[model samples]
Target: MKKISITFLLVLISLIAQAQFTFKGTIANYSNKRILVKIDRAFDDILIGNITTNSNGSFSIPVKDNYSGIIEISLLDAKKNYIFISDNTDIDFSASITTNDEFIINIPGNQINERYQNYLNYDIKKNSILPQLQNINFYYNSKDDFYLPLKNEIQRISEMNEPDISEFPFLSYYLKTSDLIKNTEIGNGDAISNKNLILDHFKNAGQQFETSGVGKSLLYNYFKLSAMGATSQKDWENKIDKAIEVLLDEVGEETSRGQEILSATINFLNGYGLVNLTDKYMKRAESLTCEISAELKKTIQDNNSIKEGKIIPNIKFTHKLNDKYTYLYDIKTKYKLIMVWASWCSHCQQEMPYVKQFYENFKKSGGEIIALSVDYNKEDWQNAIKETSWLNDSDLIYWDSKFVKELNITGTPTLILVDQKNKILKITSKISDINNLIK
Candidate 1:
């Protein structure tokens, strides 16, 4: 799993899926625009592919997935996404203006998507459209000729059965969770009841749900719902703790699912400025069983060093800085703010100035900045750091070098603070983490 980015989803696909497959589709009236293919990894999205539509509005890009999985295709110009489910074959769709608001289409060759659309249409009418019509009947025109036909049509569709997806287990899991999400959507009546329902679903969400795309949505929405009406910081954190604690009761910290949910929760909290809660949960994760998969461990641990209080060595850089220092050992300071980042990362770009400011603030007080670039292109790195003067170097190997392997650089803008003696003082991502540790 990659570092948590925007969107919440999970797709723990079946074992028979291939590492790479083609996802081809046509988008009418949307030509020559960038399209991003992405998958849910609980806390963040894994960008599988990026391609621009042809002048004819058609696109075909390679996607990494198992035979069966879920992915979201993002239209950069339209600012919209269409969710798709796979069933071991190449999944294709034909889209246009008529399907603008409705992304789901049950066209030829995609029975899984058809069934999913059936549920989506059914739920909207029964829960949203049906309720609105009932409001009109009770208040506006109960005896009008227009009312009778409209009511009957709405009633018929609302009472219709949901799509039968018994044969496809992936579709079944997705839709069932979709129904629960609809029930707990914001502005639904009975806030108290919906909150309890969210908590209950959090407890019952198993690997089938956690490993799929919608799994992340459950946790994402729960965090939003919990913080909807907080009057105080204590209340906000208490609500978050309540939901997380409920989930922990069902899954232990040692299990993969447990670690995933916990890691997702921590990343979300940290992103939203709940650093204290983030620390509390991260410490808890660190103490769990270390037998989990290495890829999964990156999401939680976010580093490769012997955590805190340990001497961190093997800090190597490829180029010389100002024709002087090349590694952490060469820096003459009591504390070192080591920044591991890539030029292409948007988040890293946003946080660079603050790190530079921090380094300047502490420069005279025994501090130095050592930037480790994971950029394979030297020009990109040079352009990125053109205005800054700091110790910069890279192997230009991009996550495959021994330097990255030894450090286990979790994600871009991975900022760590260590002393001259190579003792790692802190491992953090945000300025708040550094300030919190130093102060």
Candidate 2:
């Protein structure tokens, strides 16, 4: 019986191993261009990979079969339409990749549906208002249009209130997103009505699955919402501290990929400048980040990347001439100016010549310029690099790169100057007064 049990366990492991697949394809119809692709694991932004295409549009990528629930491939074409990949495998491009093309891939009945097929098919359309709710511009512009979609969705689910509906894992996710949107939008909207609805839903959702693993994850979201919803700065600070305490207490109980959520929550806390809330949690976050950094270093060893200071995450790009991959790293000089820009941003375009002029003088006086492009399109990034002769590395990367987010850069034409060791010489100096720094 013992031998049989051991054999069964071995077979289970073997089967899991065998359920792996690889995707290989070519991206063509361009003389010289870079491509960025994001392979999402179903609903969440898990297991993301950014790759560049060769000059001739030939490319290949490897993804975990289990994680590649519904692959989304977005191409950055300046004159052409974006490319999206939404299927399992075996990709072959059409003969021509031209500008006037509408290209989008749709994968129906995907893994999300497969896994949760047993649950009733809840129409995600009502919840689709999320993208708008999340859009900073839209949310600010049309707060009236920003209805409580999550609240409605949850109410629908709660109305059923069966073991299955209540037990569904996605309920917690909806609740969390709803909570975040509400808290972020609180005083900015019809305060009394919106805030009350948010608070009520927050309590209702928490009570439903208070004892589940997913509920544990919701605690972080709950505290995050509380932090953002506080009436005053003092209120916000205290709520954040309380949230940190709760997070620290429950940090150890997470299982599976819960550690990832834990790390992200900590990163959020750090970004909000609430690190002092819980020293123990701060240490845990730092330790986890260091561990993840070590693993990333091993995985990304070629680049002169290091885990020190507040360095941005390195993004991979395929060399134009040679299809080999390379990551852009911040080269420390006597003084360095880091410009965060996007091709689509007019302000960024307008600021380029001035930045270039600054570079011309600064280099002479011992300074360096590194412009990081946040263009979602790979071709646009390459095109912008060619059009603008800024004295900087041409290794254009995606905006979704962790570096941009780490720097807390939500606006374009934002600049940061650092010393030789990359210390903050200046946070963001005026474009006109930038030269004053070195002088």
Clashes of each: 11, 5
User: In candidate 1, what are the lDDT values of residues 128-200, reduced to their tens digit?
Assistant: 7887887777754766778778778777976799768898888887777777777677887676677677667
Give the per-residue lDDT digits (tens) of candidate 2, residues 223-313. Answer: 5555676798789878766655554454332332334435445444544545364344545544543334332232223111222234444
Give Cα distance to truth, residue 228, candidate 2, Å.
Answer: 5.5
Q: Which ten residues in a row have the lowest lDDT in candidate 1?
A: 6-15
Residue-level lDDT for 297 in candidate 2:
31
User: Runs in model 1 with CA error above 4 Å?
Assistant: 1-21, 62-65, 77-79, 97-109, 134-152, 155-161, 185-206, 221-231, 303-439
Clashing pairs for predicted structure model 2, backbone only: 27-57, 28-57, 73-85, 76-377, 80-99
- In order, the Cα lDDT scores of the candidates are 0.69, 0.49
Q: Give model 2's TM-score versus the native structure.
A: 0.50
lDDT of 1 at 203: 55
Task: Please give each candidate's TM-score.
Answer: 0.61, 0.50
Error of 1 at 210 (Å): 3.8
